[model samples]
Target: MAVYTHVPAEVLDALLTRYAVGTLVSAKGIAEGVENSNYLVETTKGRFILTLYEKRVAAADLPFFMALLDHLSAAGCPVPRAIPARDGTQIQTVAGRPACLIEFLSGVSPTTPTAAQAGAAGAALARMHLALADFTGARPNSLGIAGWHQLAANCGDALDRIAPGLGGRVADELAWLDAHWPAALPQSVIHADLFPDNVLMLGDAVTGVIDFYFACTEVRAWDLAVAHAAWCFDPGGTRFDPALSAAMIGGYEAALPLSDAERAALPALARGACLRFLLTRAWDWLNTPADALVTRKDPLAFLNRLDAYAGGGLL
Candidate 1:
C-alpha cells in the first residue's frame, strides 16, 4: 500500500522471470498505506499486485499470511490468493525485501460506504470467520493490549505533541482496559484490521478483502468490533451512523450469531479496538519518515471514537 523501496523496471522484469506471470509492461507504486511497498503491475498475461514487505510486517509471518489466503480462497471466501512463481514459491526477494505476486481482485474501496455495502462487508467478515474455523495456523496478535503499553512507552510524552491531552488519555485508557478487558471470549483467526479501505466492494457484493497483514488470532467478536469502529463513523469521526451499525450487525448475525457473553462484551471490545488504532497511529505518526511515500494518518480520529464509545449509547 506504500512504496518505501523503489524497484526498477529491469529488476522487476527479472523477478517476473521466476514466475509464469509474464513480461512486466508497467509498475506503479501504490502510496496509500504505511506498512509495505505496493505496486500495481501489468504483465503480458494479466494485472497483479506486487508487495514488498517493509515496516511492521515480519518476514517470519509471511507463510502464515499466504496459507490464510489459500485457505480462504479454497473455502470460497472472496480474498486475493498469493500467486506462486514457477519455482512454486510465493515469497521472493524484491528490492531486498520479501515480496509476493498476488491475484488482482477487481473492486474499488468505498470512501463513504452505504448501508448495503456495510451489510455485505459484515457478512463477508462472518463468512471469513466461519471459513477459517478449520485453519490450524496460530499467530498471536503483537499489537494487542501488551503492545499498546509498549507503544505508549515508546511514544512517552511525545504523544501530546500530536494533540493536547492525548498522552494522558491514552495512558488512562490502557489502564482502564487492562482492568476491564474480557477474560474469555470465543477466539479464532480474524482479520483484526477490517477498515473500509481493506474491503473492496462492487455494488452490494464484497469481491475482495485485502490487507491481511494485521490478521491474527483473536476474539471473534473483536473483529466485528473493529469493523464497527471503522465503518460507523464520519471521516472526521464526529458523527455516528446508526443505520450502518444496524445493517452491519444484522448482516453479521445472519451468517454467524454472537453469543450472549460476546454481545455483553462488545462496548469494551470496541474501546480496545479504538485504543489499538489510536496508539499505533500515534506511533506511526511520530516515527514514520517525513519523506516517506505514505501519508501519515491522524491519531485523533480514533480518539473521537474512543470518546464516543465511552459515552455508553453505542453497542
Candidate 2:
C-alpha cells in the first residue's frame, strides 16, 4: 500500500484506540505500493500495519480482500491477518476512509531474486492456491483483457510521450490478446498480483506474502504467469534469467501437478500477463501526477518484457 491519503496524528490516535494493539510508539507512512495508504504502526504490544483505503479501491471490494486474508491466513498461508476492533469488526472508519489494523509480517522482498528464492516464492504461491481451493468467494479480474482494452483506450496516443512507437505497439498487443486470450482453464482464487514486492523473504526463504487487494478468482495458470513475469525479469525487465523462471515453475509443479494443457498455455498466458502490466503501467505512468507520493514505474520495462516472451515458453 502507498501513502495517498495523509493521516493526521489525532486521526491515527483515534483509530488506534479502538484496538488492543496498545499505545502507539510511532507510525510511519509507507511509500511502496500505489493503491492504498499504509503506515508501519508500532505499538507497545507489537508491530502492526494500518491501511486507509484510497480512491482506486472500491468500498465494496474491501470485504473480499479482508475475507480472503482471513481465509488464507486461517488455512496457514503466510499472509498478514487483519485484526478486528474491540467490537469484532475488522474494518473501521477513520480519516474519512475505511481502515483496518493488520498484523505485521517481517521479511524483506528480494530485489534481484536468485533461482532458489524464486523457487521458494513459487512454492509458497502454490500452497496459497491450494489453501483457497475451497473458498466460494469470487471476484472478477478487473485488470483482465477488458480492463486492458479500456486502459489502452484511455492511453490513446499519449504513450508516445514516454517512447515513440509505444502506442502502436500497445495496440498490436491488445489486438492479439483479445483474439487469443484463453477462456477455459483451471480457475481458482488466484493472486492476480504476485510481484516480488508482494512477497517477503528472510534470507533465502519466503516468509509470507502481502497485498491481496488484487486477488481474484481466475484461471490458475494465470497466477503462474503473473509470478513468472514478476520474479524472472531483471530490474529493467529487459533481461529474463530463465534459470530463475524454471526454478519457480519447478517448485510450483512439485506442489501441484500442472496438466499438459496448462504447461503449454504458459507462453500465451505469459504474453497476456506482460501485456496487462504494460497497459496498466503505461496508464499509470501517463496519468499519475508528478509530486504524487509514489514513483511511477516505467512502462517500457513491461514492453521489453512482452518482447522477450514473444516466442514464449518461460518454464
Candidate 3:
C-alpha cells in the first residue's frame, strides 16, 4: 500500500463526521502520484480521495482548483466533485495544509492506451475546455515559463550529463520564447497536466480525469500541446504514431475547432510543452529529497521527445 503522511485516526474520524460520510471503514495512502499526499478513504457512504495539498501547490490557487472541479462536474464532465465541509466551504485546513475531499472516480489509469482511447481522451479534454470557456476567474500558471526557468536553474549542473547541449539549447529556447511566446490566444481553463496517468479508463470508455492541481488559465492550445507530448510519443520518442495523434487531434477538433492561429502556433507550443516536462523531471531527478519515497520520473523521456518533435518538422 501507499505510505500516507501524518494522518491520525482521530483526524480521519473528524473528517468523516464533518462530511457526514458515514463511518470510516478504511484509509490508506494512494501510491501513484508523486506531488501530493492522497489517501483513499472508504466510508459507509462511498470511497473518496482525501488530499493534503503539498507545498508545491499554492494555497492561493486552491479556490480556483476546487471551483473548477465544481464547475466541470456541473457541466456533465466526468471529474471529481469536491465535497463541502460541515461549514459548507469547499476547502479547509488539515495537518496545517489546505485540504479537501473529492468523490473517488472509479477506474484505473490505463497503462497503455489504445488509439481509440487516445481519441476519447482528446475529445473529453476539448469538451472540458469548451465548458469552462466562460469561467470568470484566473490562477497564475504553476508551471509556466517562469516556473520552467526556475526548474532549469535548479538542474543546471545536470543538464550536460543528461543530454548533450540540452543546457545551452534550453537557454536559447527560453530566450526565443521570451521574445515570441504567445501574448494572447483563446483563453480558458485548462488541465495543464493531461498525461495518461491522470486519465482513468474503464473498458473502452474514459471514466474520469483526475489531478487538477496544475490547472490554470492559458492558451487552450497549450493544453492540447501538452496532451500531444504525453500521448503522441513513446518513452524513447523515436516511434511516432501519426494515427493516434491524428485521432486525438481529430476528436478535439470535432468538439471545438481550432482557429487558424491556434493551429499555426501549436508546433511552437508543443516544443515548449516538451521542454516543460523535460526541465521539471531533470530538476526532480537531481534534487529529490533523500527521505522522499517517491521515484523521480525520467528526464530523458522528454528529451527524446524534444528530439522527435524537431525531426518530425513540428506540427
How does each model score on TM-score? 0.99, 0.97, 0.93
Model 3 worst lDDT run, 10 consecutive residues? 1-10
In the range 61-176, model 1's lDDT, one tens digit per residue, is: 99999999999999999999999888799999888999999999999999999999999999999999999999999999998999999999999999999999998999899999
Candidate 1, clashing residue pairs?
A: none
Give the number of the best model, judged by TM-score: 1
- Candidate 2's residue-wise lDDT over 246-274, tens digit each? 89998998898788989888877888898
What does candidate 3's lDDT look like per residue over 111-190, in tens digits?
A: 76778888989999999998898778788786888988888887886898877888998898788777767758877779
Give the least accurate 10-residue stretch of model 2, judged by summed lDDT: 306-315
Residue 279's lDDT within candidate 3 is 87
Q: Who wins the lDDT comparison?
A: 1
Reference-based TM-score, model 2: 0.97
Model 3: clashing residue pairs?
none
Error of 1 at 246 (Å): 0.5
> Which of the two, 2 or 3, has more TM-score?
2
Q: Model 3, 299: alpha-carbon shift in Å?
A: 1.0
